[model samples]
Target chain A: MELWYTEKQTEYFGITAKIKETLVAEKTEFQDLAIIDTVEFGRMLVLDGMVMTTVKDEFVYHEMVAHPALYTHPNPKKVLVVGGGDGGVIREIMKHPEVEKAVLVDIDGKVIEYSKKFLPEIACELDNPRVEVIVNDGYMHIHDHKNEYDVIMVDSTEPVGPAVELFTKGFYQGIYDALKDDGIFVAQTDNPWFKADLIRNVNRDVREIFPVVRVYWANIPTYPSGLWTFTIGSKKYDPLAVDESTIPEINTKYYSPRIHKAAFALPKFVEELCK
Target chain B: MELWYTEKQTEYFGITAKIKETLVAEKTEFQDLAIIDTVEFGRMLVLDGMVMTTVKDEFVYHEMVAHPALYTHPNPKKVLVVGGGDGGVIREIMKHPEVEKAVLVDIDGKVIEYSKKFLPEIACELDNPRVEVIVNDGYMHIHDHKNEYDVIMVDSTEPVGPAVELFTKGFYQGIYDALKDDGIFVAQTDNPWFKADLIRNVNRDVREIFPVVRVYWANIPTYPSGLWTFTIGSKKYDPLAVDESTIPEINTKYYSPRIHKAAFALPKFVEELCK
Candidate 1:
């Protein structure tokens, strides 16, 4: 007998993985979640039939989502992660000694509970002394807060279901108000292959609210398209102006000083989306 | 009812696309060749059940392979492409006005015959007056010529079956000898995800033979991994030293003057492969 899991990226295309056995499967309050062992990717996490992250390549996504925005800010002491229930982003964010406090907010507590049991390597940092885990809607959290965080990271899922509000212009405006004067924020802007219009719209929306806006990219194979993009909006600091001297030596597998600047150099087709 | 085509990248992982219909399926003397109508990727050419190229994303691969080498050299007049049966590389090569002639040598003539009929968008330039189409062994052709070409592009299949010899160090040495003193050559090095050793070995082998050797990247969705790497070996001109003003205004969906330099700036894990 054989078992396989597949996610249809589009109506006509999808990716599949042979599963060794199911670790956990649940109907969470917000979405369906599962963790299964795989032959190639070790253990894998899936939400709403979409592959969220894999043990083999989670470092790529976590490092990319956290490091670019963290390094871009000169003094990012207070940090907040919206809708990152797995705590992967917080783990990467806590690496910087400059970060005095880190807060994570997700609407679903089941994702956090299951991840701690199944994906310990990624979820261990959620219980750190400097970190705060809040089981509440990230949208309302951003709406209520004002000039609270120095660096804000949106490690949310795609624009679907409850997360649709995160991709809108008003959410970006709320995030703009939630950051300090010199604050910087980054959001996973999705792929430009099938979601070209989504990327273009998000980039344009952020550009209107922030003085400095940049679109960078990272490659995470489990995503809808392996070519993943991220958009950074800053009040004063430019991500491209991040000096080499200020880049601290952190333990990472994918993000580096040279790659920090290189990620912004989009291909011609992807460059067209930013325009 | 629905029909789908799947390629197992490894024992546990694969990518699939819905098949509209099979255009052509045959067992040629060299390998299995098939053309299928895909719902999302348009027409796709598959060899041995592995996708070689697709009409939708072929521009990314063909443009990435030809433009970097073409733009690096101050003057690229004589060019040779070995094992590019589909003539996609030749089409891109002929775009350069400096090029006086281009030669395409592939072992399988059936591929050219089928490509001309089924993939006209990619293979139309094979009949151009400036192109010399030869049905012969690429390895032998390289060995027969010594310092005869200004630029050589090895658009060959992966290191499997008859294409195994193309990835050997001896074949790279043959390419070095076949080029003029200031010659430049580029070859598809595959993806670092499943072929890290191949990329590392190719980089090491080419670095020993050429003074200016660099590894670059492109994003092609249907390939084994979305992230693909290409290596260039030059005698006099370095790909990194390409100036902005010298880059011609070419019609490409992926390549650009900024991308020409950015492609060489790989991710940290990919950069570790080159080391």
Candidate 2:
């Protein structure tokens, strides 16, 4: 018998991968979560029938989400990652030596717990002393803080269920209040192929609150379209203005000094979606 | 009473789309051909169970394959599209007023005939006076020509049955010999997700023959991984040195002056694949 897992990428389309075995599949408090050891992508994390991360390609998404904004800021001492229960983003954040404190607030503790078990390589850094893991609401944390963090990263799921509130204009305003005057923030804005309006609206809202706003891209094959976009909103620092000499030697499989600038250059259709 | 079309993107992964109707399915002289009208990706052309192009995202592939080479050359008067039977490359190549003539040489006459019937939008320009369509093998065509064309594009399918020679080192050298002293050539190098070694080897082989060789990316969701790359080999012109001012205004839905430069910027991991 063949064991396969399929995600409905759209109402009429799906991507399927042959799996070796199912390690875990359960209904978490907030969403359905599954961890599977697959043949193509290795250990896979799925939430609500959607691919959250895969072991092979997690480095691309994690590094891209952390590095550009982290490097753009003159200093990122205090970092906050909202909804990164998988700990991939936290792992990347801990790599920055200047980051004195890294806080991760996730609504679902099961995501954090299971990731640490199934995806140890990605979740290993969550145990670091420099990192703080909280089982709480990310929006409330942002709303409660004022000028607290140097860089705020939203590593949330698609704008649905608990994550729906995270994409609103009010949440962005809260993020503005949560960051220092020169703070920078970046969020995965989903694929331009399926979520064009999401990216456009987020870019518009972030641009309204931040002095410098840019949209970039990376290729994560397990994502909806393999073309993923990230919108970076900065209070003062511009990601494009990063000094090449200042880019640190981080342990990365994807992100680099040259890639930092290139990520902002979107395809013509994607650039038009920004409008 | 449901119908679905599945393309096995890899040995363990397949992307499936719900078919509203099957436009055409036949065993052609060269390969098995199917034109599917799906609810997700609209009209999709599949050859031997591999997606060649779709009505929805073909622009990304066709535009990326054509514009980068055209913009790099100071003047592209004569262009040769080897194996672009669908005529999408010819359509894009004709957008340049500087291109006096564009020739499309494809071995499969059935592909051209079926494309003209089913993929009218892509095959529309195949009948243009400035365009010449030849039903012949691309490998032999390149071997017969010497120092003739200004630009040559290999818009062939994957390195499989009929197209196996298109990816060989001898074929690349044949392309170098077929071009004028300062001509440019590019071929679709597949995606790095499943074909990392293919991209690395192609870049290495092309670099040995061409003075300037670069690999760039574009996202077409219907493709294997959505992250499709193209390897460009140039004799004298560097795609990076293209002056922004001289880029003529073209009517394009996906290609533009800004994207002409941006497409060359690959993610670090993708860049490493070329090395």
* C-alpha lDDT of all candidate models, in order: 0.90, 0.90
Q: Tens-digit lDDT track for model 1 on B7-79?
A: 8977789999999999999999999999999998989999887888999889999999999999998889999
Tell me the spans in candidate 2 whose CA falls farther than 4 Å from its real position: none
**DockQ per model, Cα:** 0.77, 0.73
What is the C-alpha lDDT profile of model 1 across A1-275, one tens digit per residue?
A: 89988889999999999999999898887888899998878789888888888888899899999999988898899999998899899999889989999999999898899889989999989999999999999989999999999999998888887789999999999999999999999999899989999999998999999999999988787786688999999999998998866686678988888788888988888989899
Alpha carbon deviation, residue A51, candidate 1 (Å): 0.8
Candidate 2 lDDT over A1-275, as tens digits, reads 89999999889988999999999999988998899998999999998888999998899999999999888888899999999899999999888888999999999999999999989999999999999999999999998889999999999999887799999999999999999998989988998887888988998998888888899988888898888999988889999888866786667888887677877877777888887
Give the lDDT of residue A181 in candidate 2: 92
lDDT of 2 by residue, B35-96 (tens): 99988888988898998988888888899899989999988999999998888999898888
Tell me, by DockQ, which candidate is best: 1
lDDT of 1 at B188: 96
Listed per model in order, the count of residue pairs whose N, CA or C atoms clash below 3 Å is 0, 0
